[model samples]
Target chain A: MPEQLADTVDPANWTCPAPLRDQPVVVMGHGGGGALSAELMEQVFAPAYGNAVLTGLADSAVLELGSARLAFSTDSYVVRPLFFPGGSLGDLAVNGTVNDLAMSGATPAYLSAAFILEEGVELTVVDRIARAMGAAAEAAGVTVATGDTKVVETGHGDGVYVTTAGVGLVPDGVDIRPQRARPGDAVIVSGPIGLHGVAIMSVREGLEFGVEVSSDTAPLADLVAAVLAVTPDVHVLRDPTRGGLAASLNEIARASGTGVRLRERAIPVPDAVANACGFLGLDPLYVANEGRLVAFVPPAAAEEILAAMRAHPQGGGAALIGECVAEHPGMVVVSTGLGGTRVVDLPLGEQLPRIC
Target chain B: MPEQLADTVDPANWTCPAPLRDQPVVVMGHGGGGALSAELMEQVFAPAYGNAVLTGLADSAVLELGSARLAFSTDSYVVRPLFFPGGSLGDLAVNGTVNDLAMSGATPAYLSAAFILEEGVELTVVDRIARAMGAAAEAAGVTVATGDTKVVETGHGDGVYVTTAGVGLVPDGVDIRPQRARPGDAVIVSGPIGLHGVAIMSVREGLEFGVEVSSDTAPLADLVAAVLAVTPDVHVLRDPTRGGLAASLNEIARASGTGVRLRERAIPVPDAVANACGFLGLDPLYVANEGRLVAFVPPAAAEEILAAMRAHPQGGGAALIGECVAEHPGMVVVSTGLGGTRVVDLPLGEQLPRIC
Candidate 1:
């Protein structure tokens, strides 16, 4: 019977998709969550896992199970040096998926933690990561409901790679997805950007700014709840993690077939993070942010939502960074500080790989 | 802040749980799903992720969601060589979690796949695996709802490691858990055992029996559904993947506080698998099996369920293997082929590691 199953898949006769034809082997960029990442999905994963829910390409796939609307999402953390400036892989493992569910306006509820460990990993190290995850889950008001652990030979793996899958209840009447972004919607960010990517790069490159930049690895569930309280008609919500703000905006624009127009001065970038990115020749817009979200909402309710975001502790620095435009579908245009407009594109690959 | 969250978990003052105290570092046996696996869970995972639902230690944690009972489980496939005689990692990835959800008496619904791939792996190889997963999911009647891909440096990972988390819906009036096993319950196995473990070992050890051996890596969800039609009061069900039939019986006995009495001659082991195990000095009872199940049901309904199982293509070799007893609680007793009896204890560690 196994052979019968094998007969269905003729790998030898399968044709390579055009975008992926040149790249015969997977590169680090394919996992970078940028243009290459999109190519991989369109060429490889979409054909394999094409479904109404998954093709939506949201952070979480919202499904109706019985009478409940559930949001499910998954992420794997391969961050180097388990511990970072302010957060560890444990925090990323929990908060990353929690934030993904939050983007769907779901009440983050349960998580499954699966770890792939290399042989010879100290139990104490894993213990620390687990406890950190426990604390994060507690902070986010979720439970780690199931877990699995697999150990590979010492040479087959790095220290530890954690994969976390989350299930949250998407409240009724809340339909937040990247594809819902529309022209004339306001673009807002919850807080400052680039700190997380800078913090990780600082550690990896052994470079120090005048002031240290720590990861903004906080759970955004509460902040998202606050936003939902203001309005259920929110169009899109995205957590810019891997490919950063640029990739998030470009993806939203592409998904919604709209253009994005941003004011350069309106975007918040902390001095330390700005200096770090400048020194590293990295764009703050393309640098990742762990505890931040970009929202697309009706222009009418934008100010009220911005006020609500500003009142919350995690979103105190929230601002209206841009607006969706009717021109140049699937493009992002930023007005420079000098009054010149330039196009912004998703990075070919993330400069800082495995930051999250 | 991240620091405030860190303040709660004082890693410096945290004490290592006693069961894990001696093993300061992870070993291959910890992932073996036997004694070491149990110890790691009880000591490490339980303390870190202890919740009412997870402490049950069922294959899939059953959660009560709005108007429905949901079952969720996670397993990561790190089986070496990617492909073997009968199955690939893709088949195992899809079937493994589906079987886990099936053990909970649930209709497997959705799966999330997270891949950890090493850089420089061929795209065609990944394509083959993805297509295989697609075919398997289609055959199993589940969707790959969401997915994530991460790339580690070449030396930091094997070719590809896939972690699959599944969600299923437990039907009304169908309750199944290992602890539900009762003293009068009868034990039945769906089909032949030890084929999967032997198949992998044969390839790894470069040994062959006179006849070819192939892995029995098929989804058991449908077979489980067929058995459920016979009776809804199934006491316990397990796939016996990593630690095999002996471990499954032993765990059931321990969980239910009952003794398991098996007739050695009734258990099915294919000739090639038995021959291969004998040549390798391996115990067939400790070998892995996919696409199979060991069920504990009321003795009155055992014959009907066995007939139902035998009629199904996947369960053609089904047989009544054993029964549960009150005497020698928490132990497994087997009557030998020579008319002697012996206690079958959970192995200190599984003989075959990563066989799943």
Candidate 2:
């Protein structure tokens, strides 16, 4: 389903509403660990890319290919409603770390979680968080090996902030990095995008859309493992979380030092999500997807990988949307069904703050 | 400088804090990641005491130690003022992990840092944090091989939070754990305590204490190496952080299933810290420390370890404060200079919120 590169650049360019230079300060919704934060990462920060280590959004990334035995990665999760939709801060903490390790093509084994709770917060919440963390650890097949907790006075902090550091073992010969993308590489998405952000946003705004949109906040270790098994040559693997598809594609292009051409017709968009985006005048491409991923692979083996992804419960909505190209190095261009081309730029400013 | 145990314990007359039974809810300061969080951990969590892995507060704890590898522990740090006196969140994130590895009689070789950033935060702040992290890694002689960044919207987060995980190599014939304490073991402290907590509090409360109280946060890998070189039989090693000396001792007692006795007069307390505590109704014993450690060694080799600790820059103020005891298992008793005795209990609640 990967589309061919467009012959010419389209004149209809979609300018981001808020340019990076316009905002001078951070807002409350930005720290919600949801959509707004992802936009910031997608727009301003990710363009300056080089290392393959930074491309994989794992809690802790695994490095060292030869005889060296080690994996490392770091992650910070700022989820508002510290106690939220289906989980607490602790559950997110443990899962965040474990998922990071998994994203690195490693079998997540251990984790370290740090908690920053505001003053006067209830101890019951701490206990609940701890319990959630224990449960999350069990679910992810990892251990909460070490952790630290600090308390800040109220006003200086939100309810609770958790940072989880994870480490895992990467089997030999598995080399997945962003810079590995090559021309003719097929692009595949694990599942739907922007679910987590939309879910959190819906709750926060108290706006009930006819259709349900829950946070796609589940761990992706199993899905990653299955994809790796089917085709280890999967060149680039990235989770389209923050900054959604636009940010992720731009990052992949920059990392691989190549251009990406996505087809509007091939990309799958849920009807409800599409309708919601239309109503809100929001671009689904810029939304966040916690549990989904975008993978680039050899064109011949793309179908195998796609089939493997689809077999996983989390990858039920898997689809091929684009292909890597040699033109316009470090750029992502998309062909609209209306015979128009638009450069899918990195997200700019806050979009649906606190969507996570 | 290791000190002898001051025999002063009357188990029959011991008192315990009233059991906490209350409604479950999260308080703002609980997310501060300071003293209050520690209280919750000790009172409600640590008592679970299910395994050795849960008791030791080391980073990326060594799991299956055989002839090939030895030592295992885990720890988490939630220090507020992510960027604070003498160090920023990055320094704490890296060194905290390295120190945990060192505490296990291991030479820290690798570390991983994870960040949870609130949305709307300045990319400049993140870049600074990353730069600080790189510098910290250089200072600790380690590498930040992998990382993950998750953005939460505003109102649910502070500026940033970090978690670190590390692994180290334990030398031959080294065994360090809390339960290893013996009746005649000597207790030695690396340096002055309460600086980190007090410094954070001073800045947080906007108190202009006459003297500058900067956090004494630094990497302890070198100091730990020096101490281990002298005697691998180091019975126990601990960082007197949140809940400070009191919490560390109680942890050791519970871990080793033994008792500890200390002389309050023999313990080292800087005049400024003591004064600040006096003014704030706080106890230095329960305050936090970033660049301080307590080591328990065999009485025979206590002097050697003390000398080694003193030789290091971080241990300039090293001193012997107490010793392990056979009676009153799982208890820590302190003899005041005034000839009175009191059981040093785990801190009951948050003291000096956000004092990293």
Candidate 3:
């Protein structure tokens, strides 16, 4: 295993950049689920869609209605080929919903799946999907409680598109929000990033490098529970999906109205992912990570939380990637590997073949 | 208005033989959101996906998680042209989600939207879509609480595909389910079917008839609430989306394990919709209806429910179209205008140009 990069990088090498203030209409990078998506949400959606439930910025939203406190979230998985290395559409659909609920500090209980299948899709393919769904539900300890199926003609639909909605219960007294990050908080990543995007891209582009890079699509309920148990002070928790680490950190920064200072040499990057990204002119920071997360915790409890997270099977590589800072409010600055520094701004346009 | 067709027409008046039921995969009919989509769900999905929440067959599913009672549902809207004569993608997405929750007798409270935008999509189109979404949310009295934006390359995605997930609150004792239909129950339709499908088709094909057909893309929360107030015994509530009325009835029959008998003359079809169907060689029963619903209620409360439904703007054309029967378990039979009897089985394939 690669050594943890968290403890070695020096903070003095970092250079901070000015905050990004301009916002654009729906751009390709917004889908990266990274910095771009975060910027769009902060600048456009958050302002227009301001509300207690939305402002929380949890993986899934925790809603309080009457006597009920429920966690609700929706995700649309449009991964091409439906099947890819390490997982299929079924697994992604189920786990994605469960993970969203988990992010809201809830135990995912039920999921509703809606499928838009292209006409002429083979029964065998659908059967495989169904089996995968059943298995995924079992693995996540949630039931496929309800579903809707719509079939479109061949050209109108891709082979299959799955949209899942999940609901869970948030335990009382556990307050988690993106804006809750404090200046003295420590930022830790659950695992290495860029695995999922790399996995998907390899298959789509038919890249033939050895060192198998499978999509890291796994349920994070246990890992989340472990960290939450150590400290509900775990203020901000976001999965680095679509747009990877850069997007997630930027979102946390803006949500808390603060800045993030990162030790570039302290961040973990798999050799295979780094090599692939280098060859493709892609930034690993802006790539997608299905089974990874960034958590902001109170400075005092950071070590305890890190140890607890690392103890969990899914969080074995947990590391402190950065720290919440007070100086450059709502911006992320990183120290380069070569002792230089740069601003990690939100990506502007499309980053195709990055959601592997 | 043209006179309703009799139950028994002369043999010479028969224009086409009954549709074949041997389709191996979905066709345009299935997408019609009418009977064909229903048949596919019943014959394939239902059997393969036998689960408690799914078997209930309600418009929206009422789920019990820990101490919370929540309604969770998901829907994908793949309507062609994205923008139609009466509404746009945003409106359909909002109403579609709201109606799904309303069907479960749940008052919609929050929604999450996920967009898959093609790379080259114009900014103007996206702006219009966003505006439409905001307006639709306001009209439905629901908020777009959370959202995700993803951009696929130009060729990979159709302009834009939207998936909306909604959460609503179900009253303490209300237990609306599709399988709850019993003998001596009356079937009521909110309004005419096939309008949405026909409207979309008209725009796509550039067909201009004397009376233009526009989609009835309206929310049905008020109608649902009014009817539920009168009788929580509303056994089954469904929106005849892709497979239209024929599919909705068939699904109810199969789920309730009872037979459904309908009078062709009692069913309401707008003159313009009927003309469109005739010109296109389609059966109105198998077309889609976006802003309509089919409700099964106890015979004693049918009149009251119909009156209450008609009071709502979206349900002004509400009418009693059928009744549950003890015979022909798992089947739906209709009396043709020609005075001949035919089995209205679930459509075996797609019915193109439908969104319900």
Q: Which model scores highest in DockQ?
A: 1
- Tell me chain A's TM-score in each of the predictions: 0.94, 0.83, 0.87
Model 1 native-contact share: 0.72
Cα-based TM-score, every candidate: 0.94, 0.83, 0.87
DockQ of 3: 0.42
Leading candidate by TM-score = 1
Q: Say which prediction, candidate 2 or candidate 3, comes out ahead on TM-score.
A: 3
Segments in model 1 whose C-alpha atoms lie over 4 Å from true places: A1-21, B1-21
Where is model 3 more than 4 Å wrong at Cα? A1-27, A34-58, A153-157, A208-210, A278-283, A335-341, A349-351, A354-356, B1-50, B336-340, B354-356
Fraction of native contacts (fnat) of each candidate: 0.72, 0.47, 0.38
Best by lDDT: 1
DockQ-based class of model 3: acceptable
Q: What ranking of all candidate models by lDDT puts the best one first?
A: 1, 3, 2
Candidate 3 local lDDT, A200-219, one digit each (tens): 88888889556878888988
Predictions' DockQ, in order: 0.61, 0.39, 0.42
- Model 1 pairs in collision: none
Query: What lDDT tens digits, residue by residue, belong to model 1 across residues B4-75?
Result: 112233222223345555769998877887767777888787788656676676889998766779999998
